[model samples]
Target: MTGAMDKVGTTGGRKRRAGVVAALLCLVVAVLSSAILVSPGPAAAQQRPRTILDMLFGNGLDRGQPYRISPRYRITDPETPERRPARRTTRKAKPQNPAPKAAATAPDQTAAKPAVAAKKEDAKTILVVGDFLAASLANGLKDAYEDNPMVVVKAAANGSSGLVRQDHYDWSTQLAPLIEANDPAVLVMMIGSNDRQPFYGTDASLAVRSPEWNAEYQRRVDEIADIAAKQKVPLVWVGAPPFKFDRMSEDMVYFNDLYRQAAQRVSGEYVDVWEGFVDENDSFIYSGPSVDGQTVQLRNSDGITMTDAGNDKLAFFARKAIDRYVAADQTSEAPAPGARIDLPPIAGAATAVRSPPVSLDDPSLDGGEALLGGGSRAAGIDFEPSPRDKLVLIGRGTGHVDGRADDFAWNDKSSAVASDDKPVAFRGSIDLQKVRKEQGIKPPQEMPSILDAIMDDWSQDNSQAAGGAAQK
Candidate 1:
């Protein structure tokens, strides 16, 4: 009995020892697995962008292949009054005509209208909206024909902010003050940087290929155009600049095309800056000194923004556009087909001699671009247009070393941090409540001067515009 008991005890002791060994082995295996987990591969998971505005301002957006789509409709959402599902059904199309050859084309689709109805004059002064690109481009504009006195640079309204927020939020409210301070004849919009993603909204989404996003985007374009119409300010649509390393760079291309489409829809002009930045392969490349110098790395250290060479090219295109449009506008008193009646020309130092070869009937321009300016940079600002952190970098700010310039002279307004707010305005600011008091045009609210509300807001403390500042 003693021997059996002793044997049992020995076996139990052995079992206990084995169990301890098994636990230690498990611990060793767990430690090895953890070590492997800690060391990731050199190719880290690319980060997605923060704000829609960040696509331009923030760096390192995911470089996922962008899905291409037609820019005819906007992918942006509306600003205020959350979108109720689209209730209005499409109107039936009257498909009768085969071609207009029989009717002599009915007054030429692109011909200028009578002076009383359509504004054909070249815009002397212009205002811009959305992102630092507009501000930087506006700052860089030069009087191309100095002696002519016909061309001039006037007021500019621009900042960081995105299209999504500008349209959805009350960012458009910021334009009131700009209108009050300086009402330009032409309004240039180079938006789309700030809003392409979710900002100040429930959804944290990337705005590429998302149908839900496109609907909202369209609303924003509509609102912008509506305001321009109300103000009688001929709009010039400036497209977004190109950048490498930005995942949304592909998405930006999609958005840029849409801007062009919106311009046509509203009888405004569209300026495409993308073509200039892209390579022969049509791929985006920030110029570099390496063997792949032409490879599209046109971004700064941060993948989102642009380089100096890029901004200068943009400036040149915009300058040419301003010159082209202004020349046409200043011409005759006659109006265009889809334009409003002309108001008296502002008392400037005599209008410029019109540029010949400029088609009066059809500018033939979807805003033609001249890739002139190059090789200028201001400090952190690049001559190229790329996304900065919370700021889409476009033009070179006022002062920087001479070598940085790529083409045109550029400047930066954001010496400090970029404002989260971009300048935007909806229809008229006049008291609509009071304006509708009487019949046609006889309301107490002093005929809504599209300029009044914008002017008013420009001077007020627009902390609400930046989004973060407003929420706090």
Candidate 2:
């Protein structure tokens, strides 16, 4: 009994030892597998071993840890002190600031600027006069002639002045002095924006647009034009553009007509700027095509004042008249004649056949009173006219051509059939039998039914079998 008990005890000890060995082997295998997965390469393996948790979810260094990059992978940056390369020098380096170095290497500022042309001593002056609108017009004219040294624009405009408020600021009194002082080649006037108010005469105050007020306003406009006329300066009256307000735009229309007559009386050119500020429907627009043909904001937020683009457009219409006057002045002083020299003619120059200049008003330019294709038909050479000639020239319909949808003429024979030598069948809801009969086509014989054909075949086989049995 003692020996058996000792044997069981030894066996139990051997089992425990085997279990411990198996557990150790599994632990070693697990550790080696984890290390293999966590390690990136041989280089990474040489560095400090990372924890399993660290390998799974990145190291705390990425989350603002105070760890500096290793010197092996550190890039040299001047901004970073630790990353900057150390330079070996015999003497101490001087303090460096890039600002002074950049300044020293910079190009000369004066040399980069373009040279501007100087204005001529006898340059033609364009005197612009009127209210606030005229002030805007002056600004536009200045920009227009900014590059032209021979033209100078002078603004003698009173923003609050108009023909109606003569007592406050009379254009009749102010205009003559301005023309005399400037000695302008062209006198441009763009007012009436402030003239919509009531007119005050010597006796009583007249309502705006009234017959008495209109007459008085006309006289005032005439007076201003007379001043420019007496000065021998060419007058250019720029009409008021449409306003944001409908009633104000209507008033401008009436004012423009009066300005037109006044300008006409003095033989001055009247520039109508109404179409520039309005849409196709003649309605006021705050934003529209600019002088460059690009869409841009033209009016101020208040709607009454003009923006830069609006001012430029206003100048555009008035610039034509001013340019004409300036051109005339320039051309008036003709240059001295120079000696003429003729060149030798070429050996083989083709002589151009020059036709006499045709008058635009001449009626015979476009084949005269005769319609197109209606000229006299060629004699003896018989040919049918084209559809266009038939319909247009003769004012007649294109006659029916057989087989076409428009052909309604019914005949025994078809044109298509005659050409192809085959009977053409008509499609649609037409009776096929009638068409076939008209074309003289015989109807096909009726086909036998399936059961009748089977019965006929059976009877022929039975007769052949009976004839063979009788012969046997």
Instruction: Kindly give the stretch of ten consecutive residues in candidate 1 with the minimal lDDT sum.
Output: 416-425
The residue-level lDDT of candidate 1 at 187 comes to 75
lDDT of each: 0.56, 0.77
User: Model 2: runs farther than 4 Å from truth?
Assistant: 1-115, 201-203, 328-472
Give RMSD to native, each candidate.
40.7, 27.6
Stretches of candidate 1 exceeding 4 Å from the true structure: 1-123, 143-148, 154-158, 166-171, 199-209, 288-299, 303-308, 327-472
Clashing pairs in 2: none
Candidate 2 RMSD to the correct structure: 27.6
Deviation in Å, model 2, residue 467 alpha carbon: 87
Error of 2 at 376 (Å): 42
Using all chains and alpha carbons, the TM-scores for the candidates as numbered come to 0.39, 0.49
Q: Lowest-lDDT window of 10 residues in candidate 2?
A: 344-353
